[model samples]
Target: MRIRLQPLAASIAVAFAIPAVAQTPLRTLDEVVVEATRERDLPGAAAPTAGELERLRAATSDTASLLREQPGVSLYGAGGVSSLPVIHGLADDRLRIRLDGMDLIASCPNHMNPPLSYVDPSNLKSIKVYAGITPVSVGGDSIGGSIVAETRGPDFAQPGQGLLTKGEVGTYYRSNGDQRGINLSATVASENLSLSYSGALAKADNYKAGGEFKNFTATGRGNELARNEVGSSAYDTRNHTLGFALRGGNHLVELKLGYQDLPYQLYANQRMDMLDNEQKRANLRWLGQFDWGRAEARVYHEAVDHYMNFGMDKQLVYGTAVNGMPMYSRGRTTGVETKAEIDLADSSLLRLGALYQHYTLRDWWPPSGTGGMSPGTFENIADGSRDRAGLFGEWEKRFSPQWTTQLGLRYERVTTDAGDVHGYGNAMGNQLVDAAAFNAREHKKTDNNWDLTALARYAPSQAIDVEFGFAHKTRSPNLYERYTWSTWAMAAVMNNTVGDGNGYVGDPDLKAEKANTLSATFDWHAADRRWELKATPFYTRVTDYIDAVRLTNNAGFNVLRYTNQTARLFGLDLSGRMPLGNTALGQFAARGLVNYTNGKNLDTGDDLYNIMPLNTRLSLTHELGGWNNAVEMVAARAKNKVSDARNEVRTPGYALFNLRTSYTWRNIRVDAGVENLFDKLYYQPTGGTYTGQGTTMGINSIAPGIGVPGMGRTFYAGLNVRF
Candidate 1:
């Protein structure tokens, strides 16, 4: 099946959203092995069977990497387990990311623990991507769309079948970073009760680039980093989850517990590293089916303990703390959600929902010893709190089989506040003056944000479909963006989230961002859906966009403060797939896609930072018996339209190829692949500045104009067995 979502007229098909989707029998994917599977559901990956998840897990441990194949989606390179996702031209806090009905925020100022990083790829059951326009029921408190991720759902044995049991074990290795990992899951069920558990562990050392990217071999510490090595790129992580479910005549109840422990995840673009991070989560949900329709209610909570400082590659500086410039962050989140769906007369449907989330965070650097690090603890963000309460409604009706339309509205009340903060010293580094100025200001803020979506879809014939939509969304600033009070270079530099090798201060009076977008999609396909083509183009204008301005006169990595401005973004996505016919030995197919985006600051007249350049991918796939294979080509154009404000780096165009093969038997499977097959070297356009080593605390300490390099050629293989 070819499921291509449109760009315009958000008919959300969130006019057709997952929250309101019925749980019918989906594809089993048991007959073939695909490198990755596209969801049959429009606009999202709401459903994926075990077979699909297994195939995706065989090659990578990074969960964000799984979505790279999706159109209109890009990534910001970060730690091994954490990568920020970009939809259209917005990223990070600009979009909504949900895990098991819960909205998780990054606790670390450096954004080392993005929401997706908490769930290991091996443990994911399904992930949905709502690319551009979105309906009120599917999203709130965000300007862009949404990505919803969930674990395996509950399962029950048939009556009179006694107890049922099943499990899977898998392992994989990648030669480039010496990466290795193991995963296991077990489940037991009865007619009315089910219990399951899943766990994964992965670790790796620094990886090398295809070719030398620098001249220095020293890390400015007692460490050695070869010219071809990407320093601060190593990581060790483990994750575990347990779930229980109970079902009765017309209702189902479920409880889930999740935990993650990442001892360390070095960063190639930032000075600080995640030395230790721990997350604990619990969620409870209930679903009931009634004559009127369906109803759902859920409550979830999450707590985090995070620590950061210099890693092995970066020179350790400052304080009496054992790990150098020790930073600590503790956060807690609690939320409640409820929704109801009503089936109206004449194929009309109405959805109404309400949600509330409360969050608290404390970020501080304990006094270590000497210089500015002595006297007192540095309070980056003290007693910070952000709360949101939202309500949404949607109306959808299939006027006929060939015509469908949807409309939605959402409103959110966001409030934020913080306690007084202080620096380490009274005079050193202007700690006294800056701290006094910040402490005297009132820190409370509130915003009443609104969102609206209008969409329509038409299927003129079996071979043609058209969809278009318009959306207006709003988002308030996060704690790190509005309450991180500091102007001292050393203190501000440690608070960066964009990894640009710059210091960043926060503004308390920043306004919420509002965006208006226009979009449309045209799809053409064969009657049987074996061959398909899709084109999507979109444009968005934003008011009070959160940009930044220089706070200091220092050149290259100076202090900057968060501010508001006007901006515009436009983009296109093209994709097509067709059967190449069958032969005596195998069946062949072709698939290709292209993505292009341009963003500008209307106020500053400068290009937006980290906008992905034009890129394309093409692949030839073949299948025979239980064997499946593909040869892929990936290329990107030169990134010369730079962001002068951020002093973004420029890179030349480049191309690389890859080979993949997989074989599946009754209960066993094996996968092998070689990436960057020819060992081509390249820099990541969105990977941000390189501050992976040396004495990185001082402004302009690291060399300028360097971007994080892509990984070198790698050989990877995996094996999985199910019983």
Candidate 2:
């Protein structure tokens, strides 16, 4: 019998760009290999193929938005382009994000430009997400698992063949926000050399909400009323990359240079917005294969300069003078990594690697008219630096045809230091207790951390497989978590990853966080590979988890201090797919996924901030000659268990429907979709507080407390052509 696999809406839209490859015959679970990691499959791992990535990119310009549908994944809204991904309730620096071969760091204090923002989705070739219990060889200094994104690699012509050229162009538009974007890429290749260039531009107006209207009272404008326009939610961005590659007998080397410019991006969850942002990056890599082993090495550098201020939407309420103060931050990262895979005894392999990184950061605010101190700068972090070095080894062995096992270990040394930091005092230039105490203490610290991983896979029958994994992971505190010296209102608000509108002061004496995770996966598949079902359950305990403690409750703001606490997290992920026999009308299929996670501060007996609520997605798909369509339903449970420390609010449960269809004609393809079909008004459980200053009359105002509102009904369409 021939097995037929159905493609979902996201994957079907890209079928025209690149035809899908034939699937290989099913093999025993012990023989399954993950192409991205070059290792056996791990529990709760998802890797989208190239075609699926292309289709997903056509729908949204934000890189993080692509992961929203994946199991065990949720998004923390910040700016239009800076949505942060959360896995099992861990976010931001708590997770290791690998872009291409480089470990990129967030440059902004507000984390405006995360690692994923560096690479546009239009240029991505593949993405792999390890939800929990990640392999030691692939990640370090993180407990939330790892995300790896790679751009299209060089493609060379066959030997004795002539020069080859390829190019693609695409454009998309969305109705709700009047958003528009364009992407272009071109490549030229010879037998020995290849060159490529890609670029993208995206812009959007403020998105509209889904409710009624209210007049503005803060601005004292009786004529002005907010019907549904979400305040401070507009953005404009551009990215460009140039790459070159050379191939020799058994070795290949590649070089890539990238530049990004974001002129303006409003943040709904922060007090300020990104005004000017720019980044420059360069990466050099070498890959070689020999009879004995395979070797890979990479060196990369990144420089970022960011500026933040008030946006036009917020100025209407606070006035331009009061919110005109501009904040500046600069960051630089230089890193190198080398790894080798060696052939050991039969059915066994060994892998070794080493990595080093040097990072520096500076955040300061120049004198401004509306500021407390004029003609003097407030240095949030001065000459802050962190250096890390790690070494790791892994061994994989097959004990028998039915069983496979792997073990890995890693050691990392981290050192961090910062120069004397200063804060803006009251008009008298007298320091507050938080700043005085922090400046009087030592500024240097070091940590020696270790990680361990053990995993095994057992296949008792062709249709049944079981996998178990255990991991011990460690992460040193980030510079912001250790070096922010001020307890002032503005300084206290900078130490945040959940976008909660609160102030925080860092504690330089905090210890590194360590985590232990245990996870298991069960997979059941048909003999012909037509359908599959997978279930995963995981538990984690963290010692010295970095959290916030309320220090003082001011009239308008609450001051928080960073502290360490014990935390626990438990979660389950379930996914399945089945094919309905083909009929004369078309081929039909059904697929669904459900995810649930609970996180708590074991020491404080409080719910963790920004924990995603239970959610599920179900879809029905239809395919015919050159046409594919899908209808999907998404549902989420209400979030009532709020975090008192962060003053988080509860959100009501909601359900939404979406419809998508795509058609392919030769080298040209068209995709169209309608999201939030019923125009339901809801809020995402993970979306943090609304910090945009606006009239208190509207439901989504800066005052009276409001969560980030979801976008209203939206219709989008796109076209792509390849030659």
Candidate 3:
């Protein structure tokens, strides 16, 4: 199928370059793979499973809002500006995100940056998403997958004494039947150092309940409340990202700094109130390609500062005479990482990398008179750090023009330390614990890991190709899970209580989660057609699967524990694009993707928590001269599967509609789109749990059912100009 669409895709690429699009063309709808290893596109990647890059200068909000159309990917509704991607069953820290080859970590328990939010969509040269085993160059601690966002490189457009400048400023207002909100952004870029920055501040009155708001009373009679709380449960947010990139000769570099603050945000899925939340990050990367092969390197650091409260359905105040005051706690994290890659000959590639990070956490209170829970503010402050290093190599040999195979291997070492930390009891929630003093403990541990891959490709003819691959990968535990102490505001806790209180004590004893992956794909084209199709099926087995579970000690709150257990994830992906005729009018196209995941917890005999549900995305796009437009429909069946683990909540299913349009002219372009067009109401089919307000001083947030409810419908628009 891919064989037939290559010519049509090529022809459209040519027409898209003329007139309006020539001035500020978005990424090539169909890019070729070069260095992406698995599927390289422009600076990003060429895989169709990925979404197209809409011009950032023409974007309405943060990049996270743009990716909501992807299948199995949804936003965790804190508000418009602060949303997190629930990637196929895996969200939060499970996914590995990189910018210009550098890693960016989220600090907020609520997850502010949410991967796509790190880079101004307008500044992105391209975005490549690898939902499967992905290539070794992009692998690390990634069990669900990887997403690489790249900035525009120098000499990417035209070489030799060239000056290009582009910028945009715009605002949009949305009035759905129940609520209203507005968003805006500004961006600019150039060849020497591309700079694109965007900021959005927005608020919405409480939405009219789609159906009925349930009132859970201590009595058996649950009341059916009217949807009359207009503006009563409203929320607000502020999000921004500033990115700069320098491309010269064979050396290219990029840097991005971003922040997200969502205060007084309302969520229908949880029992608490988000009074304060913040996410801050700085990411840097450098890449150089020599005559031999190429080299890429990067470093990044970020911090999350968070505070919030729950327990009230209406206005309440407890601290400093604040109205509707509620129980509140705070926590923070500072982390850093660095990595490097070097490509050898066409047949051989080598990569070496290391990551070091530190996290200091404190969970405590400041006299909330609302309840007797504030015991003169007892606190637990602990320090945690991670040191990791690895070496990897891959070699691909082409015996013939139609046949090629590649083999890869990686070895790594990791160490962890938790110093000067204590777990609090009674005062926060645990009874066996001390409320008047800080419990202190120390520990250190190390681990060794290995990865392997084998790939084979065959081409009966130039237009048809088939590939099969198998790989083994493993990733170390994150700093938060292995050495977290105090309380997680989102989970509504006051102690590091997962794997066991031992996790907070710093279990340098933890081992890495290992995965064995197998995959097969086919790309076929007709002899004389403008069409193509691609399909892939995969299965992965994880040994010593690391997960967070409630502690058996049952002291004050649930402690987060990390342990390896056997688990499995398997699914299929299929997509195709076709052109009706050779002319510009017949150049319309259609594409779609569907994926699924099913796994078991061999240790406890339960389903994996918060796994992605079966989902699909279908899009119809058209190209006519200087004008391009598209409409996509996305849907996901709810995952009713509930884990047998205690405190686990199930999520609900949801569907959304979206539209995108763009027109290009000489040095000018305009692009606009609307997501969740219908303002539909739905929650994640998989849910998570946090402590309820006044429940205790230990935990804060939780996914209620399967998952939390996503955002209602939204619309975005923007413009771009180049000189």
Candidate 4:
């Protein structure tokens, strides 16, 4: 398949040919929104709004991919839609993710679906990332930091206006995998009430690599001739949401409902593929403002039914006799949170909040002829449940015109348990050694977690600002890490987070992880704010860090057991932007960023698994009447230090280039881009192992030690209409 670039070029030419017209001045692209409270110099914080967000949304459909350029942020690929975000070397459950103030958890043991996957990029209005040493009031049960994604909210008509209606439609296409998508949103509003609806559909075929194949370990049979294509990397998805809101005086109420359907998705880092996925969610919120303070409350519920099995591509070589494993999982969560802010004095304010959550899960598999197992049902985790209650307080003080400080603390009580679990041997009236050993253990646990944060900011002059932060955070293990109840390879693999193509068993006696971190940020800006530079450095130490331990080699698969260890991480992030004086043709700007992180196991003296290599990005942007254009370069250092315990492989470093342009005319917008402009062949340091069927390039063909290949050169275009 080939994409014609002539038409895209013609479109750009036509946009430039239009006669110039008088228009309002456009906002400079270098301005950034500071989402943190009164103090704008908070360490390790970023909020990309307006034009920056629109440009990012046009680049990819995966929500997590949008964070790749943020300081200390990286992505761990799972499926086409499920790219997990990592902050400062920690990922998955270690980070707190909230969408529109609602906390969501992944139902799949493989983490095929995460909180960010629930919101399409087209629906997002803004995103805020809080890096290491996050504020206590903004984080809970997490150590890495927090991410908040807010969707488009209701808009009301002006007073004295009777009614208002508006809508938008958008479509995009990518040639790399023949990917295509469409989004629709509409709204109706009156003086006091509003209604809104949103819908999206997206699909893609397997993507191809930039070069020819090379056989590696675990690349599978008959895959040696895969050429440039990465098999089984496809997906189909659809989503819908409805919202309503009412306002009276200083009080407002809102409600929202959402639904998602994912019929099929392939996981290149997993042994099984997602055959079906369905989810539903509902949320309600209330906000009130009084002379002395403000109060807000929210309630939400989420549920998912997911299934996984062998794909046709894999069965062709492995066959039903050796493969054909099927599994099912169901998860439901309900929660409520309320917070209030009070005016204590002219220079001080106090914030308090309380939260409660209840969660339940079940995972199971049914015996079938394909595997030649006894006829029965095996319960991986049955009636697993977790409940949590928390309370927090925070205070912010402005000491003087040049100084500000904040302090916060939080406490949480968590309890977990599960009903008796059974394996196929029990259903077949036989005592399997693995099943008997697991069934004999207790399944109830409790934890008391606490969090603390302190930060201060000072602006010595208009051109210089300095900030410092410190935090102590705690997190308990998830249900899968405590209640998997089996030592079998198939059941154990479901509890893994690193996606290293290995099976894993859970440890019921695991302990909570506690992290202590200190970070600092320095900012320098021109008097007019046209040029700016920022740098942040951080260090963290973790007690009882969750890690994996090798168990046994069964059949052709390696199995691991979950355990706890001491760990440490340190990193630095630097960014800068500058604008050149405007010329007759247009305005120009330059921006760049560099990020690096190091992580190690304190007790074992080994490197952390899948740590990202040092990377940097630079871009030059130009703007004319109504058009914007940019050229970007991305480069990374070679990753030679690998984790021997996980059988990780080292990858050579490479550089790639990309081009993008956009134009707006009246109520219509057009965007076009070409990625991998140089067609460089490279590997993603954090793409996990190749579990897809067939043989490909790598060191270990039977189990492949090489990382997944990066996508080849591709062209993309998008159109949006709004009124």
Which candidate leads in TM-score? 1
lDDT of each: 0.82, 0.75, 0.49, 0.75
Top-lDDT candidate index: 1
Candidate 4, residues 513-544, lDDT tens digits: the string is 99999987777776555677877789999999
lDDT of 2 by residue, 424-501 (tens): 545432345655677788999999999998887777776766778889999999888888766655455655556777
Model 3 over residues 1-723: C-alpha lDDT tens digits?
011111121122110111011111111221122111123222221233112444332333445555544433444443334355545455555566666555555433333334555444444554445554455545665665556666443233244536544444434444432232333344444445566666655555554423322333121112222432222245566667776777777677777777877676643433444666676767776666666545555566666565655423432433444233233333333334343434444533344445544444443344444333343443333354555566666554555666666666767676766454432223334422421222344356677877776776666774565667777777777655555443333223322222111122223446787777777766655543346566667777778777556554432324454556787766665655565555636477676767676667777778876566677788788878777788888788866665555444545566778887777786555667766778676654542342221222223222122223444555555554444
Tell me the lDDT of candidate 3: 0.49
Tens digits of per-residue lDDT for model 1, 404-469: 777889999999999998888668778888888988999999999999988777777777767788
Question: How badly does each model clash, as a count of residue pairs?
Answer: 14, 3, 77, 18
TM-score per prediction, in order, is: 0.94, 0.91, 0.74, 0.90
Task: Please give the lDDT score at residue 314 for candidate 4.
Answer: 52
**Poorly placed runs, candidate 1 (over 4 Å):** 1-53, 318-323, 553-555
- Pairing residues by index, what is the TM-score of model 3? 0.74
Per-candidate Cα RMSD to the true structure, in Å, reads 4.4, 5.5, 7.8, 8.1
**Candidates in descending TM-score order:** 1, 2, 4, 3
